[model samples]
Target: MNPNTTVALPQRGPAEHDRREQIIKAANEHFRHYGYSKTSVAELGKSIGVSSAYIYKFFESKQAIGEAVCAQYLGHIDATLFAIADNGQSATSRLRNVFKSLMKKGLELFFEERKLHDIAAVAAANRWCAATNHRAALYGIIERIIVEGREAGEFERKTPLDEVCMAILSAMTPFSHPLMLEQKTPEELEERVVAITNLVLRSLAC
Candidate 1:
């Protein structure tokens, strides 16, 4: 971790933990409503009915608060992947399920928090390589699934497993882009995800 990173020290008591969670939630709402650059500590404190100093007790700075919000968002993605891994499905099926879940969650985030999603999208476009590697751990899980599937003779692709993982991730990127948010129902989005996932699976599956 960077020296500048203010680690969220684990809260000891119930009240303390609740307060910290409340501050983080308030910050997330503020960031979602007004983009990261526009959200102020004072505005966040006012929304949470606390003084700016009190907010600082839980979070060190606006950038720290932004990191917390991003961590929470990515944490959700991690949980979904873990759930799929625990579903007792074959490796191929697990990979498909994970991608579908990810796409569904992306759509939810894109539509429900358009401003925050837009901010993240712009950041990603500007730092595509770093953003891509930032999620390397998650992609590693998919690569392991591909390797397992290949060993089981379930996926016949001769391309390297890492390449296959990248292809799967690439297929899901459209769901996260702002362009996809125009005039699309949840069901339609879900169908599109399912179709794309199936196509990738077909191309790779034995």
Candidate 2:
């Protein structure tokens, strides 16, 4: 799925919205326990005290439910990163904070639970809209930091802004990307986060 693509959702009344939330909540729990690939819409509906047909009214297919759950999960991280980006810190400090916060949250949310991690891994591998959008938002945050740093004379301006942003993101991907986060132990991830964040900062230095 393209990160920038938008799906137009039909407008729902308050009751409809509440019902959809209920379904999503139950699916999240089920997926967390049994994993996305193993769980079925019929099973999720039964758990939520609804019929499989009724569940389909809210979500077109099991993949739609999975996407919704994954989106909700990533929404939390998006909020955390956005807050750090706008916290009025120096660009250097904000950039470092962003990387560290992302790595920490990625591990705590994804790696701590293997089943939930699988959902993320699948979303990433399949290029689900949830994962793509999360990545796009992260790039925006990084670009914003670079712009601020350039304005404050803390980052080099000779390089194109987008190029620098992409370079930093590429360097930090091992720690921030879902599939790569589990490639190392938590202790090892932390060490790499520090090393990569500091190295990126050095490269950005004016």
Candidate 3:
């Protein structure tokens, strides 16, 4: 019976969201350019023209900022895979689209945004077990697609789905590894991804 006892709250508008994104973007650039070890909160804040205390308001620490950047990168991959899966295409077509998008996106992030790629690589290597878990989740998405394709009789393979999934992920390793990606031109790397993907498809197809 206390109608007037309701509390009012402030709404988070687009501007606040945009400012947060800007801070993250600036942090990502700094981490990428200087490597995570060299990047400091004061330097990042200076780059964004905010005080170190203000940076803390957004992210608790540099490690937290790095994790957020990595999450953003993985989010893009998840979105692309889900979009392809939702399309009304054949299973094979969807699978192919996923690989193509993966390769293209990987190349863009590795070559064009080389600094960010390096930062992520260093983080993942140092955090091996956590990185492996993250990778397993990513591969689980791909495995689901394979399972659907197999159920529809679109994919034919004798291997267990988990094995096939590991193979698919193994094929993508070069793209994620900075040393490997560094040794090749973007075109060459793209070709390598396509070749490996084709091999996996051939093994899986009827």
Top-TM-score candidate index: 2
Off by over 4 Å in 3: 1-25, 32-35, 45-60, 128-134
Order of models, best lDDT first: 2, 3, 1
Per-model lDDT: 0.67, 0.81, 0.69
Shift in Å, residue 127, candidate 3: 3.0
lDDT of 1 by residue, 1-206 (tens): 32112334232334357667877798788777778788888998888788988877766666556665665675677677877866767987898788777767777777788766665565455543223333553565677677778877888867876667777767766664445444577788778878988898889867
By lDDT, the best candidate is: 2
Candidate 2 error regions (>4 Å): 1-16
Clashing pairs in 3: none
Tens-digit lDDT track for model 3 on 94-163?
7777777766776787767877777667657665332444465557657778888998898886788777
TM-score of 1: 0.68
- Candidate 1 lDDT at 150 equals 81
**Candidate 2 lDDT tens digits, 156-194:** 999987788778867768866788987898889889888
Per-residue error (Å), model 1, residue 129: 11
lDDT, residue 139, model 2: 79
- lDDT comparison, 2 vs 3, better candidate: 2
